[model samples]
Target: MNHDNLLAPYAARSAASRGRKHEEPYKDSRPVFERDRDRIIHCAAFRRLEYKTQVFVNHEGDYYRTRLTHSLEVAQIGRGIARRLHLNEDLVEALALAHDLGHTPFGHTGEVVLNRLMADHGGFEHNRQSLRIVELLEERYPGFDGLNLAWETREGIIKHSSQYDHPGHPEDDDFEPHQRPTLEAQIIDLADEIAYNNHDIDDGLKAGYITLDELAALEIWQDMSALVSRKYPHLRGERQAYQTISHLIGHLIDDLVQTTTENLKAYHIDNLEAVRSHPDYLVRLSGETARKNKQLKAFLYRQLYRHYKVERMRIKAERFVTLLFTSYKENPTLLPRKLQQRFDEHGKERVICDYIAGMTDRSALDEYKRLYEPYERV
Candidate 1:
């Protein structure tokens, strides 16, 4: 079936996509956004997300969410919202999956170290790095360096923002940075928060970073826990925690859908033009949900993220990234031959940052050992 036939006027229909940077023939059956989604899923950078950390380090545990799983969860949530609103699910899914393509291994700590290291050389930001990946990094097509994604998907990735992410892609002048992105792109921002917050709660509890008694004090957790207990009276322990988290995700999705619908009506957004011209995001939480979410984030910051154990891992990750960047900067020959050639075009600091940003957690660690350890195999 032709998917483009179903998009609403306000939706980003594939037939009308801004198209790729380098023009290519379209596969007749698949919509452009669907092709974009397929291309992203098949890219090498997408696969490396598995070894990249979300909260805990890659070596911390098998159960903690990796960037890959987090991306999938964001896509699932984004699609749910898109379907509910008759928006473009394919575009939402593509944005969701591709948003984290440029994330460094070992989570935000790695980003911090790399940013400081590159301060003299244009600086580093994951959102910009993500755009760089799609526009320049991934070498899939012989004709193009990056994935050559549609302009909309690239904009969505650049606009990916949340409590932690401060989105900006100054180099992406093709898309209007001053205005809001499509509502489908906006959904990924909320989906990222909903996915990470609830999943982190599970991981935190399992890691014994936070306790049930302590969680009981939080408003959102308590509200969901009561619902889980009422619905599954016999469920307890890990099963209960799972059920509660499941309900909480549903709760957040419900709030986002309802509130976003209200905002759409309030703003008089009729088509894609209105969404772009709007000054602020049209998709967001209700006042009540936003207030409660603030409490939830504040609690996580003081209780889980700032916990001494998590800080220890952060320190280690920062050290790994700093040392690795410094070594490569001192001697550019250490990079792979192909990357060494790019140093003339991309420059030493940027080429090194690209190489480091592209590495998976274990790959970064292994590289560290190879360079610093006398006995480690190169």
Candidate 2:
């Protein structure tokens, strides 16, 4: 697995990879991170992402961004950023692809209900569940219970700082919370933000939940609008909207690259050691872009995320997850035979939680109907 790489001095080199939790023979063609990426892609949990929620549920629409597409978008942006900065593209790609593997079917709504249900066991967070997935849930290889991913990949999953994920929580206790993750891992967070924000804009527009005229009120929207107009004067309607999003993504990446490069210089961080030991995170957007991005986020929160339609989905998601948990808790026999066998080892509630968390949105709904309708297919 020792492949020659032209990584930045501060980049995470594959040769220096902290070995997996379980030892295994290495492959010759693909490097460690590449294998990690392939392993994630082949896992059952990763495939379930197609039906997992991002903003809209699976049955909501065909075109809306699902968890699968969102993960792909994050990887696309992360790889572009990684390449530009001479960072580890393979690790960045792996982190981006694997980051959302632990997300529940109904998105944050599912996570909230699981947290409430498992309050006495251990609170549920997608990030921790993600690590749990790669560490012990995915029973792929004969010798290992989980993927036994490289330690750096696992650390990135644990500490993937995002708008939804804040650091210093008890969950981060497993690692050195004081030190920063690799430069590549650090990029995943910002890349996630960049992907979700812009894609949300697109999905909201396509769904008619948000209008172009409404977006005019936001400064970032106006900035992009002007650029799109000038760059392609004849472009109109949906095409204009699409191009504006493309332009915005480009601009954000430009800002992030520029800002991260400047931070590297400002901190005099010459190597991976310096990046880890730095007191604060050094990869970031410039001040101006940060403010603009925040404004856009606020607009999405108020206008799109908190809008009546999205809230309605969130409410139903809560109920579905809650009822499912309750039913399983009352009658453990209701769970599939395989999961029932896990109860003795992991506890009934934890086993049930894992079973439910692993379900796709469509399958969860199907399970509900099968359980409640009586006449529905078993």
Please give the CA lDDT of all the candidate structures. 0.88, 0.90
Runs in model 2 lying further than 4 Å from the true structure: 1-5, 27-29, 167-171
lDDT of 1 by residue, 83-190 (tens): 998899999999999988889988888888888888888888898998888888888787778888888888888888877676654575767878788888999999
* True-structure lDDT of candidate 2: 0.90
| Candidate 1 error regions (>4 Å) | none
**Residue 36 lDDT, candidate 1, scale 0-100:** 84
Cα lDDT tens digits, model 2, 154-234, are: 899998978786456676776778889999999999999999999999999988889999988888888998999998999
Clashes of each: 0, 0
Any residue pairs clashing in model 2, and if so which? none
Which model scores highest in lDDT?
A: 2
Clashing pairs in 1: none
Root-mean-square deviation (CA) per prediction: 1.3, 1.5
Estimated TM-score for each candidate: 0.97, 0.97
